[model samples]
Target: MEVDGNKFLNTGLLLVATILVAKLISAFIVPKSRKRLPPVVNGWPLIGGLPRFLKGPIFMLREEYPKLGSVFTVKLFHKNITFFIGPEVSAHFFKASESDLSQQEVYQFNVPTFGPGVVFDVDYSIRQEQFRFFTEALRVNKLKGYVNQMVVETEDYFSKWGSSGEVDLKYELEHLIILTASRCLLGREVRDKLFDDVSALFHDLDNGMLPISVLFPYLPIPAHKRRDKARQRLAEIFANIIASRKSANKSEDDMLQCFIDSKYKDGRPTTEAEVTGLLIAALFAGQHTSSITSTWTGAYLLCNKQYLSAVQEEQKNLMEKHGERVDHDILAEMDVLYRCIKEALRLHPPLIMLLRSSHSDFNVTTREGKEYDIPKGHIVATSPAFANRLPHIFKDPDRYDPDRFAVGREEDKVAGAFSYISFGGGRHGCLGEPFAYLQIKAIWTHLLRNFELELVSPFPEIDWNAMVVGVKGKVMVRYKRKELCVKQ
Candidate 1:
């Protein structure tokens, strides 16, 4: 067939032009269509990174951080847990609204422990109100009364210690913290009459949060069974206490009272169940964290003689100024001891990982300017244990240097808002932070002023196996009673 060469060439040129336009359009649209997920930790097919993560979460994160950068994901069986490792990329994780990053799904394991209609079991709005109850109960004014109880508990507990002896500081602090918590939070009734029973029940509840329980909370496990029984017994006990208080028309200066008196924004009174649940949640939140922090503080202080001496010097100066009285205001003045406790918490945050369930896709930009889009349905997490020790944010991150938080240094503030998130940060930041600090300070201050302490055992290792990571084994310390020289 005779063809016009000019016509055929023109047609071919037109086809090429159309193809090029399509290519150009694709170049712009394709990039926008594909979301860039954070680097994934390679694992076996199906099982994914569960084994390595189960082996050691912090260790796995440390190993992967250099290779994967700060933002990375580990697929655990069916779920994806994306970790935001440092403050540089953690602001969004801390600040995102509940709609974006929901805690309700990821922390359902806490439902059984905290009881129904509270915390992770409740919706975000209700949870916020419940949290407000905690906030009100732990306010500075409420903490003043709590601190007085803390002081009394500390003085009473330590007075039993011999003039000169060796003891497991860890055991002592754990026991003492529960006593203080019971007095200040669980009410004077539980503290005085039912201490041992309530304490054992709490132990059962805490032990129920195994790794498997996170995924299968209702599994037919012995620990879960014990936890359920303990929770029931606790409810009955508290219900009786609540009823007795109501019948007698009595009120007490304690967290139990605070929760009992707590009213919703609409003015509805809290139910017996709600009050009990709030109290359980409060004790659960503060008990382990405070004890673990207290133990770590003592361990670190004893290990670092210079810092220990600094705290001792601070205690001496305070005694001279305040004449042996240590209250909330006095504990607030304990900047040296506070720094030491804070440094320890930075190194060993009891709740290693803070988590949320991503309900919508979001993007995060790291300090290095690398950006990644996190897709929905992933468990978003930040490790305070890892983040608090980032070399870029904290100098000699491994070393127990309390002065890093001092006025002139303030390394924690060097990075940004979430740099020092041992107690977490932003909207979901720990409401119990001030209370935790004061409780630790009260214990340590009394010890510093009344006893000369020395580390007798080797430094304790991190008990990574613990649900609330803490010092492994006993923290043995030698102590001798010392007379305080208060100015007349």
Candidate 2:
């Protein structure tokens, strides 16, 4: 009995020791696991704080800024995203080599839709070749013709409003912009009856960027299914368009034609699938960003009458100076209107975060004597939505002031390359930027000349789940025909 009691006591002691050791190890490791974060971090520990972030990415960012400081860490979906926000950090995104940090790692989820052969999926070498071809086709000379087409398309779209009682501007504008982009960038025939289905697919695929996919990329979830469907539909659409272009012997001027004519460094022609993916990438790149920005553009104008009048006056002078024609040269001279657009972008950039992942280990220094070692797989993001609103970058950061971008101001000198990243930066910078600018300018010029506009919705409340910074409810607007009491 004594021996058995002694054995039982030994076993109990061993169990107690094991539990104590585990408690000690956890206490030591948990705090150490949270050393100074890499350049940035999103939220607190296991709780993730995703609800806080989902409230409004931009708003959450604003709330976290003072609490977390310029650089901090947050966990979302068991993943760490470090945000190196502010103008200085934002500048690094433009200047940093694509080799040191890259977009592909962070945006890999898009591959299911964009395809493996797409420029967005390929290595820097292939992207270089593709971007060169894209730039040539979308350069100033090529854009002039497309800009004219965009203006005509805008007129037709607005005509649907018909001195309107009320209309959902966001929905109508997205359709208009995407259709015009498909026609001008892809090809006219590609913009036919098929786009209604294509647009629906794109919308569904865009909704797939949830925590589920971030956690399990291969799962047969709704997001994955929608992504797959969009990919197949897009591929089919592009295949038909390419076949039509070949059969008709169409001129190779549009972006689709550029893909058809491009040759890789080995002098091999791009495959049909390659051409299709490239076209889809271009279409996706152009449509949503412009639509979101334009919607905000209208919203901002409605809220601020003074700014709206200034834009209208500038448009009037531009039309009179250039005879109501939109060319690249005329676009250059619409300086005040451009400033207004810039101000709107500053206030509500289409994206809250410009995500990039470290391709290799990197080091960045904060204002303090602290340095962070960013690991190869670490996700890095910058919020132009935040950077553009920085008090140091803009004098009155929250105020919607176009004069901030007027001649000779520090805001005016906000480096077109990096500091102002409404279009993003680096080698991966948006190829459709120039064309997008011209399209927005043309739309504004045409509309401001013809209609008196007012907002019917209490200004848009942010929908953070949106691929772009989008609004939850529809933005309704009332448009009255301008009395020709004075011709613009």
Candidate 3:
């Protein structure tokens, strides 16, 4: 043994070298191999981030975004909401199949509002079919007819404005949007005869979506009680209309008729309940969003004189070419006006956040190349309001610049598909996008053509209090009828 000391020393040195190599390998590889959850926002005991979230979800997201980076989570009571903040980290969020990221669970709150057996109440397959119905209802041909109705509604509504007067623009747009939506989507009966009653009921329905309602939709509260009543009454009203249409052997070119005429892939015609529910869903989706966007567009244009002049000039050129004819094609030609409205939506998207319940685990790599695993059962969310304002995505993101979307810049397309999600993108993108654009354009084009508008009130601030964020106070506007008239 003593004679073999050199061999023994060499063996000891080799063993030490192996030990050091193993340590180094583990130090480098083990951390890389472990599961990485998104950064979690630490909050109060048990209740977690609920209070801050309930106070201001967007503000909370904004505050946490800088600290947590693009992917992060905030616990609200028993729920863990993981946010995918930007386009780079959100492709799967927008594109995932229902089996991977299901919307039904996250949107169960809409059940009480949209009623049973339609939309959130139905399974994924049925929901897809229903969405198809919406898509068909808002097709280009259908939207052409809707554009005519929108123009008529806008003219009729604004014709009452005195030659020069001060008015609340927000109020005016809200009133007009409902009338147009009613005429186009709810049928002429609701528009001509029952506008006030139906609009009031919709008000009740809108008020029912209090923040707490998301968690306790069926709670025994006054708002919920009124909401249930409104739902029932709406069903009855629509049922009568459907019956009358069927019995009279009459049809109309509107979303109501479209829904009545719709059929599932299996060839099952929609029921009265289904029609009513779908109509309600359609109105709910468009009415407030259109109004909010319309107000923002006007507000932005009035505030930004250069953009306002650009849009007005576009209208002037359109009138010179079309001679006061404002059909779908003419409206389509008003690209300047379209960009203005789109920019407004980019700044103040009505639906601030979109959500999905993660049904299975998924990995997302962010723009910066950071990867994070979003676990099953987590509530996955993305914010259009936040993402649209990312400095990297849009130059001077906070400033109102419609030209950013103009041909040469096309900032929205610069970051690729989901860069501008004012109407969302991918699987659950808004089917009513064409309708929305046409509707807003119809209204704004009329205003620019027929009236000179000025923002009379201090520019309204974002009413963060609203479920659909919109102008906080009255957007008082002073308007005068234009003396120059182009033949219609």
Candidate 4:
């Protein structure tokens, strides 16, 4: 028995050795290069450029994009990622027709949180269909109700803060945005029942995007296990909701309800896994980005009192015009407010880079006629952070100028179609732009109108280590009750 066991162990070790050797060989050998791909900072030998890469969201692509010039490559783990910066090349990621660039393969890393068959995992066609359904369900008519919910929730949140001392806008917005998105996407019942689980899932999932384990997720890492558990908890919650909703023969007109009623291209109802996946996708996208933006917007308002005052004046004007109730039309008509939000997204976009995977070998020619034939399996990324800040696109790119988006402004038409890509670009762009706009605008409008924020610090420092950009110190501000405040 001992001899047989020893022989079996030896064979298993031999097989493992063979697989590792093959993988190492495959990683090292690049096919005959037609063009020289950009040189990268040296990193760990087997991991390539992973050692030098930023440990935060988009793995520090935000900082690297500027210094590395227009096109650069970095070997992460065993995989090589080529980042395309500026509006022109970045547009190729969003606008190329019949291209092999697909978001599914690259973004599938998110599946541990978003689940299989989710928007991030699916192709453009399915993503569009799911988005269309969400749009129909959460239409402009439906937005007023969501705004009302936001008002109520904001009121509750403020009551708890109660003319606060120091509050973590990060935690505050996380709770508020999740609560608000839950109300808008799942309605009150589901949001109430599953709120804690949803929050926990998002918290865990956000941690999962760390660059460390993303390169080797199955390696028995603590973050990996937590990520899996988070997904399991979220999936369990969604699964129970799906089963109950189906069993009760009831459906509400929220995003989840839309998924439940949806039929695939084959004209059959979506599977439970698909439904849960879609729900998770909607919640993840809807919640986090909006939360980050709202938090930043609030912080910027506190820091820039003039902009804050303008926002308050705009909100007051809208309230007066619409009799103190926030309507979709009222929110939409706040042109200056929209511009401020656009400027905020310009200054601090929720997502730093647009990620895609090359499905086949492709040639790219810069306008200057510099050409590179990129082979398949190379991860491709585009930066809206860079595109939105391109000097040619915006005259004073770094300035937070809302006038850039103001009505009939030259800045609106002064530059590239691909320049402003906060919601991303082309077919794979964010499906919830309108929904997100409404949610954020409503929250800010309510708060700005109802409160006065005094910033203690001159500026808040942004922590860019994770998927979402957050502040190191909670945005420290004193919120004076609106009822007691005089016009400044």
Candidate 5:
């Protein structure tokens, strides 16, 4: 019996060794593929191009695009990514269906931050229904109400400027947007009573949304642990709020109620866990984009005097027509300011790159009639950073000229579809675009009408460390109340 047992053990060990050797040999064997593929950006073995990609993905993409054409493959660690650059490729990317491309797979790393059973963590149909709640919450009628709150918050928050000395626009806008979003979306209980603690927790949560987290979400690290804790604490906080609301049988007209009242196709009520995840996702979507865009817009306007004068003139005209009463309609007429914001977004978009994981074999045809076959299980990335810089799409592509979007020179549309993708394009385009414009327009109109600001610091470079690219350090502006200054 002992001899038989030893023979069986030795046989099993030999079989495992044979399989391991076969797998190791296969790891280095490159598959022969049909159809043309863009050249893979080369790097050292095993790690491949991960170090370069981590250093500055935009820089690496730009360098590769010029050399490898619009479609190219690059390896990052064990992952193979095919980048589709320029507008034509962008059209194909944005229009691809869920079967061919899976956003959930690409963004599953966000599950920890967004909590469970919501958005990218769920099945596709469920996610669609979940996103419907967001759409309903952002509809015109709801926005009509949200705009009032937005204006009120903007006026109340800006009332404390006190003819400001030098203020860091980045720091101030981050706080301002969080307060406004919390008051409007998360319910008054959270905004009024739990603001500080919630905001602090949100900070820790935001810190955990880095690129490294996207790669290894479950790695035992301090920030990842803090992120998990913050997510749980936020869930507890929202659960308490929901319990109290149900106990009182009270309903409030805000996103929290909308989420609570939302249902699946089968009529199942949304869970409290889902509600908390929705709020975190909503804030996550709008917070960084709004805050960063506001800072960039402020910095750009301050640095360009001609555009500043033009926007200020438009604001003065609005004031002459509407006085201190700022509303949605008045905000709409500030077209010059709108163009300036649009231009700033083109230059420094909040989310620099959008990624999708390919689920099946797909073909991409370039303008030259060349077809590249993308294989299954490869990650695909589309960068606004590169798309916006396509020379033929925008004349003097690198210059900051807002007029490029004006009148006969509507450059965003000049190069065909997906040319200007600051807000993204196609089925997955931004739903909060109107709200973003309204909030930003309200704040800037008020600032332009109330204060004169000067750029007190040199234009800061991009802080590549942030998940969203933000201006480095302080973009300081020296300010004095316009009402206090005598007319020239």
Candidate 6:
């Protein structure tokens, strides 16, 4: 009887010891402050909930946010990732300076693609200046010239496909934008001489930017090797172009010219290497974003027949007033088309989530007066993908309704703040927004006036595995030359 009692006592003691050890480990992780820390569910002894979080961060976050409230910490192996949600939380997060929350730490994968001494690889001041060059190139007056290039390139692309044909816009739009971007941004030398080679190199760069690269950038993988090789090759090509421009003592009003004339704070002309890096950065920013947004816009508009009819009606009015000639001012008058694009962007933003690595201990107080501390070196995150779908911010969030953005409705403004962050908010917001809208508007307008398009299949499943999530597999569309079809 004494032996049985001793055995039960030992088991009870072991259980108590395990609980104390866990509490000790938790205490060791962070200080016990008066203010509460974000809720972190009990996970594995050493690794925590990393494996579960990594499986589907988007799905996991969505599930946890409701249970844990607006602010919570997700323990990833040894790292603590603090996710801030709600309108108030988003405003503070987006407006926070780079000093407090660094983007470079989370986006280190950009080092190989953008090369050294540029973008995420360099200081914020340097990157800020570099982005300014891009903004200058895409300025209002400069963009006026690009409209013609967009129209011309788009027209040329559709011209090759007879009176009727099926096009996988996944491939078709990618090629079209490459041509348009090359013509308008990369300059005449790229458009006329090095188009195919540059396209192939960019493909290699694209292949390297896989979702796995985000977490494991330095893996000894085939794609990473190809990505490095492609980066070197593109640098060589851009370097030669810059040299040739200087040797010829000539100039053109394009993005390349902006890079050539771009002067540093030190009064020295920008180097070929820096110019190359800047060009790659601009391309990286616009490449998938524009392509994916365009893809989504087409997929959604086609699926929603009533909206498609509305777009066609607007296009008819546009052509009546302006005739066949297209320009920036004329494209701006496309209110219906504009709202459609806006809705598409809201529903399917290119970057689902944005990350920041907290540099100092940051305190977050919710609107409800709940306080939490975000420890230094922890990752801070916000998701435009999820935010755009918030019921309070967007009415009937899942429904494809552009009328919500109409003058009287203006649902986006109802939230009165960073509610609609499809283009992001604050300083690091997408600089290419105007350019992207202009390009998309130009392409769609041209297609509307020229071709009769029909969706061949239902909307594609979102391919979350892609670095920038896009419609999975082929997005096929059938189009007939409108004028020819009318005559027939």
Judged by whole-model lDDT over C-alpha atoms, candidate 2 comes out at 0.74
Give the better candidate number (1 or 4) by TM-score.
1
Best candidate (score: lDDT): 3
Sort by lDDT, top down from the best: 3, 1, 5, 6, 2, 4
- lDDT-superior candidate, 3 or 5: 3
Q: Residue 330: error of model 1 in Å?
A: 0.9
In candidate 5, position 54 carries an lDDT of 84
- Candidate 6 lDDT for residue 182: 87
Q: Report the Cα lDDT for residue 89, model 2.
A: 46
In order of appearance, the predictions have TM-scores of: 0.92, 0.86, 0.92, 0.83, 0.92, 0.92
In candidate 3, stretches whose alpha carbon ends up further than 4 angstroms from where it belongs are 1-33, 486-488
Candidate 1 lDDT, 32-93, residue by residue in tens: 56788899999999999988988989889889999989999999888999999887788888
User: Candidate 5, which segments miss by more than 4 Å at Cα?
Assistant: 1-31, 484-488
Predicted candidate 2 versus true structure: per-residue lDDT over 376-458, tens digit per residue:
66677788878777776678888888888777785736644466777777656778878887878877777788888789889
| Ten contiguous residues with the weakest lDDT in model 1 | 479-488
What's the TM for model 4?
A: 0.83
Q: CA RMSD for every model?
A: 8.4, 4.0, 9.9, 6.2, 4.0, 5.2
Q: Mark the 10 consecutive residues where model 2 has the least summed lDDT.
A: 33-42
lDDT of 2 at 310: 87
Question: Which 10 residues in a row give candidate 4 its minimum summed lDDT?
Answer: 479-488
- TM-score, cand. 1 vs. native: 0.92
For each of the candidates, give the backbone clash count. 0, 7, 0, 1, 0, 0
Tens-place lDDT digits, model 3, residues 1-488: 87699899999999999999989988886675457888899899999998888788888987988888999999988889999988888899999999999999988998998989999999999999999999888888988999999988888888888889999999999999999999999999999899899999999999999988988999999999999999999999999999999999999999999999999999999999999999999998998899999999999999999999998888878777778788999888888888998999999999999999998988989877888988889999999999999999999999999999999899988788899999989999998888899999988888888888899799889999888888898999999888974423
Better of 1 and 3 by lDDT: 3
- Model 5, residue pairs in steric clash: none
lDDT of each: 0.89, 0.74, 0.91, 0.71, 0.85, 0.84
> Of models 2 and 5, which has the larger lDDT?
5
